[model samples]
Target: MKQWNIGVYFSLRFQEIAGALDSALAVPILVPVQSSHSDENSQDLTLKQSVTLLESLRSCWSEDVLLISCADKFLRLSLQLLSRYSNWLSSGLADWKKGSVSSNPGCEWAISALPDDFIIHDINWLAKRICGDYLEGILQLLSTCSTEVLDLVKKSILHGGKSLSDLLPSVINTIIEALVDKSVEDLRQLKGITATYRMTNKPLPVRHSPYVAGILRPLKIAGCSRWRTSNNIFDRRC
Candidate 1:
């Protein structure tokens, strides 16, 4: 089996779409923050650099989905690092305040505050900055993935269990339904071609049944389109 770097694939796909768009906005490349477990000092430095990059890109905010993608790849590393940094700032401010009284207290206080001159490092603010529209650009990106990559995603979801489903938008169910319908249509076409080839003793064109089957099997296994339907029956008797 081949290993796929889903994070890189997702970022590249997002960039490709952003480039084709008419707007001047570009998707910002969010580098995942490193964990503090390995080299705390270096991790802190990298975290600061990531923060600086985000600040620079704030003016051209395209979608918070990009940040969500980063969080998905990095898991709790990004959140934990940011939270620790914020606490560090608060503790440092307290120490500074106890040690010396600045001649200009207002300026000093404003400079020391977390949200005053920087992104609020809390989870809620981070969510606002990273998931503002709530999976707006995500579906677009997911639709563009190649069938092979989609298969890999399906496997990952299965191995990781259903909890991963919460990370996906409800709109994905509709997309899956469309995919299954298309696959069924393709299979029908392939069957017709196979029948024609058998009768005429001519070689059939390359069959895409396998590819379509590969795509649909995982979707069915994952229950991507499991929804209930109801038919209304009304009768009036006077």
Candidate 2:
């Protein structure tokens, strides 16, 4: 028997994360839907727009965010369900994989926040299998947009169990390679710096924590106004 070891991490502030996301995404979604209600033909057109916007917003979120640490109960539960879902997905016999847990409230927040979109009534009646299908479809749509998105799909698969940093370099490299047209030598240098810093055995620098905080800020947002004019990664929208 092949044992697929999934190292699950649980983290606190899960609701806080969800709350921040809902706040950021909900309003931009509502406008198109509200405009659609006035006329029949225009309603249909606006409704489609609303659906796309909502779907995109929902799809933008990485499920991996919820799985950040080993202490999160919800994350553990989600993974257990996902493991079953993945197995079912791999099985050709099953038309769909069923998740024991419902992530529908997240989906509903997405849907109600954009009501003009066609409301599939009785959504509650759909089997867990169908919800899995919905998530699968949403992820599939996101995968086509950029190398960054494709790397996310790859991580979701390979990340059945792994440290987050273990995946960061590959993803960053993919984004840079696909969007920036960087050469292999440039990439190797970047990866080398990341690995040396991350894997070093030293006690860490006096500025280590802040240095990490600094690294997280997108280069353009880091107040190098001079460089922003020439290499505006912020505008790239990756």
Candidate 3:
């Protein structure tokens, strides 16, 4: 009888698992769901399988396994899978407070089970992956992320192994976009609440006096003017 090599067995099994994930994640980007019924169905099936496999892998994770030489492959695969399924995971997160069931329960479970170090690694990988071609989509994704994720992304960009000079333009664009989005959101919320008060014939909360608003208006305008001038300069540089 031949003796079994336990080490070889585990190595082969790990490779098989990683290969399965690689195949699942190889699905090509299809046309918009509205444009191609068959492609949409195929994409959905691929994502479902990927999410299922991800949860299975998460269940098997341990400190010992994570220390293995092949673990980086698993980590890269996990990050790619997470990025693809981020929308599903984020939607699930919003339902946590309401005790509502998630649409993608497996994704929610897998994401919640990920270690903090893994999360940080994933964020760093994503930061390094961003490029001019994918800047808009990546920024949109990051903008909707939690503060913890955002902070990690910033740290990765500023302190990670990349050259700062090469990333300056992308960094500038990201900051401008984030600032603009935040300002717009704040203004929208303020206008919405004030409008609601007007509709209900209720007096608005008196946090700031009318004199304060008068003083702030010119300052706000000046800030906007400065931003516009800077934006013009950015456009010229680009």
Best by lDDT: 3
lDDT of 2 at 178: 28
Off by over 4 Å in 3: 1-3, 30-46, 59-238
Query: What C-alpha root-mean-square deviation, in Å, does candidate 1 show against the real structure?
Result: 27.4
Please give the range of 10 consecutive residues that has the lowest summed lDDT in model 2: 116-125
Q: TM-score of the candidate numbered 2?
A: 0.20
Looking at model 3, the pairs that clash are none
As for candidate 2, its clashing pairs are: 9-69, 9-70, 10-69, 10-70, 10-71, 10-72, 11-72
TM-score of each: 0.22, 0.20, 0.22
Q: Tell me the spans in candidate 1 whose CA falls farther than 4 Å from its real position.
A: 1-73, 100-128, 131-238
Give per-residue CA lDDT, model 2, range 147-222, as digits (tens). Answer: 7755655455334323222333433343343233323324444555557768887664565443344343444332
- Candidates sorted by lDDT, descending order? 3, 1, 2
Tens digits of per-residue lDDT for model 1, 81-129: 3333333334334434354433422223323322111112222233343
Question: Which stretches of model 2 miss by more than 4 angstroms?
Answer: 1-16, 24-29, 33-72, 75-117, 120-130, 134-238
